[model samples]
Target: MTLPDHGGLSGPEEIARFIDDPLTSSVLTSMADICLVLSPEGRIKAVSSKKGSPVTGVVAGWKDKVLSELIDSMSTEKMRKRVDQLAKDAASPEVSPPRWVELLHMLGQGETLPVRYALHLLHDKRHVLMLGQDQRPTIEMQQMLLNAQIALERDHEAQREIDTRYRLLMDFTSDSIILVSVGSGLIVDINHNAALMLARTRGDLLGKSLADYFADHTRDSLVAGLEKPVQVGSAAMMEVEIKSSQRRLQLSGKMFRASGEQLAIIRLSDPGAGVVADERLTSNLRQLFNHGSDAIVFSDRDGNILAASETFLNLTDVPSASAVRGRSLAEFLARGAVDLRVLLENARRAGQLRMYATKLNTDFGAQVGVEISATWLDDQFDPVLALVLRNASSAGAVRPDTGSGQDQNMQGVIELVGSSTLKDIVSETTDVIEKICIETALELTRNNRVAAAEMLGLSRQSLYVKLRKYDLVSKDEG
Candidate 1:
C-alpha cells in the first residue's frame, strides 16, 4: 500500500516517510565520521564525512561511485552479497538483522585503510545507509592477539615433546624407578621394571601407597627410609621385603622438587643370592681404598701415625712407612699442632671432617695445599682416625684470589691488623676463603649440585647449608 506524500499518521507508513527524508540522511551522517547512501544496486548515491576526519583522505571522491568500486575486490563481493540480502528482506515484512562488513577503502597512493561498515536497509526499499568506523587500531590489536596465541601454542608443543622424551627414557630403563609424592606415600609414576616387580600394572600401582604393598611390620621402616633423602639431600638405601612378590629388594630414594611440590625417586634392586660373592666384593672395596690415588693415613686418637699407604709416604716425602710410623700427624699439617687438634675435635663430634683445606708440610720443608677428609673409626679393635688427603697445591692454592696472587692476599690480611682484632681478622679471612672455594666448586661443576658436592668433598646437605649461610643462591632461584 502507498501512503500520501504529505499526511501525518502514527504507523509504519509515517515512519517510512521520515526515514526517506533528506533530514534523516543528515542525521545519520552526524552519528558517524563517515557515512554513505547506497542504492539497491550497491552504487553510492552520496558520501559525507566530518571535517578533519581521517576517512576524508580515502573517501573524498566516493560520491556517485559504486560501493564495489570504493572498496577492494574482496569487500566488493561482500558488499554485493549484503545488498542482495537487503533487497530480499525489503520484499518481506520482517525487520532484517543488521549486516556488518569490514571493507578496505582504496586510496590513490596504493594504500588501503580498513573500514568497518554498519548497514541498514532504509524503509524506502531503494537505498541503504552505511556508517563506517575506522578499524585500523582494532584490526592491528587483533593481529597481535593472534600472534601471541600462536606463540603460546608453540611453547606448549615444545613442552609436550620434552615430556615425551623424558617419559620414554624412564620407561625403557632397566632400573626399577618409582616417583612418589612426599606428602602422600602414594606412587605418582613408575617405570616398566618397577611395574613388573610390584606384580601390578602401571595404572594399578599409580596413586597407591607404596608402603601398603610391603609387609605390615616393615611399613614404618620403609616410609622412614624413603623420606631420609629429603633430610640428607641425596639418596639413602634400605632393604625391604615385599610381601606381594616375596622378594628382598634394596630401595634407594632421592628427594626432588618439581613445580613447587616435593617428590621422591625410589629405585629398587635385588641383591643376588650368594654370600661368597658379597665377601669378594667387600675385599675388592677394601683393596681399592688402601691403594686409591689419594693419600690415606690411619692415626691413633692422639694423632700418632699408625699406618700409611704408599701414596701417603710419597706425599710426605718419606722414604718408607717405617720412617713415618709413630710420628704425630699434626707435625706435617697446617700450623702443625693447631691443625691436628681441629681435625681430631671435629671428627670426634661428627665422626667425620671433610674438605678441610689446609697446608701439609713435607719432609723437605715444602708446604702443599691439601683437602683432608678424616673420620673417627671407633668401632674397630683399636680406635683410630682415618685421613684421606687429596693434593690440591698443584691445583693452585685455596686462598681467595683478588685477581692478584698469594702475596697480595697475604698483604690484605696484614692490612686488616690495625683496625680489627686478631680473632675478627681470622674469622673474616676464613669466611672469604670458604666463599671462594664454594664459588669455584659451583663454577667448575657448571652449577650441578651433585658434582659440586663431590668436588668440594662435602655432603650435598652440607653444601646446601653453606649455600644458605653464605647467601650464594641466586635471588631469582630463592
Candidate 2:
C-alpha cells in the first residue's frame, strides 16, 4: 500500500478512488474522535468514528441527520455561518485552507458534548467533511483546579482570624509581658504594658537587646537565666535595677518553643509598688512549705484537703497533689475519723494542737508513725486548718519512758493472791496481762490496727476479735 507522490494525484478519477478506499476511512478516524460527510444542503451524508472511541455509539445513528438538528440551539447559528463562509471560500477563484470551529452538541438525556471541528471542501465541491476532537478531559481538569483554589483560600482566612485574636489578647493584658528570641537574646515582641514600664514605645523595644534596659552588672546573668529550661509552675526570678530610673524591679522568665524556634516569655514588676512588710515573710513561708522535709497540708474546716505540699503527696504514696485535693484528709489517717475528730476538737479549743500522734496509711498498704501539729486559722471570711506532719519512726529510740500505766497494771496482776481457787486466780492474771499487752502494742504503732497486729504476732482477723473483746476499736474502725 503506497501513497501517491507529494506532487499531486494523477487525475480526478485517482483522487475519487483514494477517497472511497477503506484505508482513507481508517486514517481519518485515527486523526479525530468523529468524522462526518455532509451534502451541500447541510444534511449529514455519512458519519464515522474511531473503533472503541466513546463517541462511536453516540454518532452511530446520526447518518442522514441534518447537522443543525444534532447540535445545541446556540451552535446552530455558528454552524450556519461557518458553512456559508466555506461556500464563499470554495466559490472564490483563490483556493482557501480548511478552518477549525468549536461547537456544543446536545446528546439528549440531560448530557452535552464539546467538540472542536475543521471543515474541508471536497475536490468535487458538493460535499463537506467535518473532523472533531473531544474537549471533555480538558474541561474536567480546569474544574478540579478551580475547586482546589477555593479550599486554599478558606484555610488562609481561618489562620488569619486566629492570629488577630492572639494579637488582641497580648495588647490588652495588664501585666508587663515581653517575648525574646533565645538564640539572639533580642526582643521579638513587647506588650503595651511592658513598653510603658520601660519608658519606651513598643516599636522602639522590639528588635532591641533585652539586657539594654537593665544595669550593666546584671545583663549577663539575666540573659543566661532566661536561656535555661523552666518548670511549669516555678519560673526563674531575679531582682535588678533599671538603667534609666535606678529603680529596682523583679523579673521572672519562662522558656517555650514556637514555630520551630526557642523563645522566652518574661514578666516584669516593680518590687516596691505593692510592698507590704509581711509579704516577704509570707513568700518565705510558702517556700518553706513547698521545699521543707516535713509534710504539710491545708484543709477546710470540714477536714477536706484544700492544698497539699509535694512532701505530703510523697508521704501518702500519691502521684500528685491534685489527686488529693477536695478529698477527706481522714482517708490517709490510720485511725480514720477518730483521729481527725480528736485533732479538730483539740485545735479548736486550744487554738493549736502539738505532738498529736497518729499513723499515715500509704497507698501501698503500709503504715508510718507520724506526729502532727495542727493550727486553727480563723480568718474573717474563710477559716481553715493547717497541719504539719513529721516522721516519728526514727525518733522512737529517743522517746521518753512512759510505761507507768503498764507497771501499775502488772503490779495489780501480781497482787492477785491465793484467796480464791488457783485456776480462778490464774485466769484473772491472764486477762490483766492480755489487756496491758494490747495497750502497749497500740501505743507503739500509733493506734494502727494493721501495724499493731503485725507487731503482736497475730493475724489481722485475730486482732479484730481481741479488739472487739477489749472494746478498744473505735466505732468508725468497727
Candidate 3:
C-alpha cells in the first residue's frame, strides 16, 4: 500500500508519516499478513495488519478494492467465513477473541488465497483483528487429499457393521458421494458431509436431478447415452469427472436394479485415483514422464537428469526416456547452460529466477529455445528448481526494461519528472494543506508530477485515476 505524497517537508518527512499517526503508520508499513478493514455497510475502510503477523510483501494492482469484491479473496470458503464472522463479532461486548485465516494450497504466481480463518473482535476498539497462516502446500496436498479420501472409503464399513454401514459410507465419505434414483437420475439421498463440502444445503440438493449438478459433458452424455443400460452390478464401477470452481473431481459409481427401482451410489475423488485402485501409481507416473505440459528434465544441482517428461523429450525430438534421464542440462542442451551466470547469481539473491530465456539442443541436432523460470525449494537455497518453461510468446510479455514498469511505480514516476524520489513524498498524503506543498514541489522540482503527487496523493481516491492518465494540477481553483 503506497502512501500519498507530501510536497515539501523540510527534513526527510515522508507524507505517509504526516497524515497517519506513527502507530497507525507502523501497522500499515509492517510486513505482516495484510488486513482488510471494512465499514459496517461493507465498503473497505482501511487495509493493514498488526506488526507481528506473519506474511510480508504482496503484489500490486490489488491494493484498494472493497474486501467482498476482490477476486482472490472471494473464492475461498475460509475468507468468506472470516468476513462474515468479523462483521458480526464487532457487535458483541463479549470478551474479544483472536481470529486468523489459513491458506492451504499454493495459488499460482502473484495470487493470495486464504484456506482457513480465525476471527477476533475488539468490541471496545470497534475493530477486528485477524492473523492468517500461509498453508500453501505444494501439489502434495492434492495427492494427500486423494489418499485421505481413499482411506475414508476403505475403513467406512468398519466404523459400523450394521446395515446402515452402507448409508454411513455413502454419507460421511470425504469424496462427493451421492445416491441417485437411477432411471430418473434424481438425487434420492444426500449426505451432510458432502453437502458441507460442496457449500450446498441438503434441502437444496435433495430430489434434484443429478443432471442439474453435472456440467454439459456429463449431462449430455447421461441424457443421450444411457439412462438405463443393464445394471452391471459388481462390474458396474464407472468413473465420471466434473469441474468444480477450484479443482476437478472424478466420481466412481455403481448401479443395481432392484424391484424395478434402479439405485446408484457414486464415490468421488481426484481424477487419477480411480484408475489407481491398486494403489499403483505407475500409469500416472508414466503420464508425468510422457504427457506433461512442460519439457521437464529432472536433474541434480550438477545438472544430471534423473528423468525427463515426455513433453520435454518430444520438444527436443528425443526418442527415448531411457536416453534422457541422468543427462546433464549441459548434455541436453548439447552445449552448456547459457545465462546460468545471471540466473544463478539472481536466484542467489532472490531465491527465484524468472522470465529468462536460453537455448538447448537434443540428440539429433535439434535446437529448441525456451524461457525458463525457476524457484528454489532446496534447504539453504541449494539448486532444486521448479521450472516454468515458456515459449517465445509467453517470454516476450515480461520485458526486463520497459515503460510499463516505469509508469506503474510512483518512485519511477517521480524519477521520470526529474524530482528527487525522496523529497516529494509529503504531497501524496492526506494532511490538510499537504496537497499544496505536493503541487509546489512538483513545480519546483521541474515538472516531476510523480514526486509531487507522491507527497499529495491518498490512501484512496483520484490518485489512481491520475496515475493511469498522468493529469495533475497545482492550482485548487475551487
What's the TM-score of each model vs. the native? 0.47, 0.46, 0.24
The clash count for each model shown is 0, 0, 39
TM-score of 2: 0.46
* lDDT value for model 2: 0.78
Per-residue lDDT of 126 in model 2 = 76
Model 3: per-residue Cα lDDT over 71-105, one tens digit each: 45434466567657765655666754665666442
Q: What's the candidate order when arranged by decreasing lDDT?
A: 2, 1, 3
lDDT of 2 at 443: 60
**Per-residue lDDT for 1-478 in model 2, tens only?**
1112222112223223425765665677677777877788888777766555667667766777898888887788888788889889988999788878888988888788888899887777778778888878778788988888888889889989998987898888878899988777789999998888888999999999888888853446776776553664678787767788887888888878989998889999986776786799899999998999999999988899999998888888988888999999889988787677767766776788877767899888988888899999988788899999988767552434347876786677677665677787788778777877787667644577776676567999998898888777883164
* lDDT for residue 240 in candidate 2, whole number 0-100: 69
Q: Choose 1 or 2, whichever is better by TM-score.
A: 1
User: Considering TM-score, which of the candidate structures 2 and 3 is the better prediction for this target?
Assistant: 2
Report clash pairs, candidate 1: none
Summarize candidate 1's per-residue lDDT along 1-478 as a digit string, tens digits.
1112322212222223436665665566666667777776677666666445556645656666777776789988888888788778778888778888888877647767778889887766677878888777687899999999999999999999999998998988879999988777789999889888888999899889888877643445666776766445678887777878788888888878899988888898877746679899999867866688899899999999998988888887999889999999978885666567667867887888777777888899988888888999986577899999988877454634434543555577789999999999999788768876787656434466665676667999998998888888782143
* Top lDDT model: 2
lDDT for 406 in candidate 1 is 38
Local distance difference test, each candidate: 0.76, 0.78, 0.52
The C-alpha RMSD in Å for every predicted model, in order, reads: 20.9, 14.6, 38.5
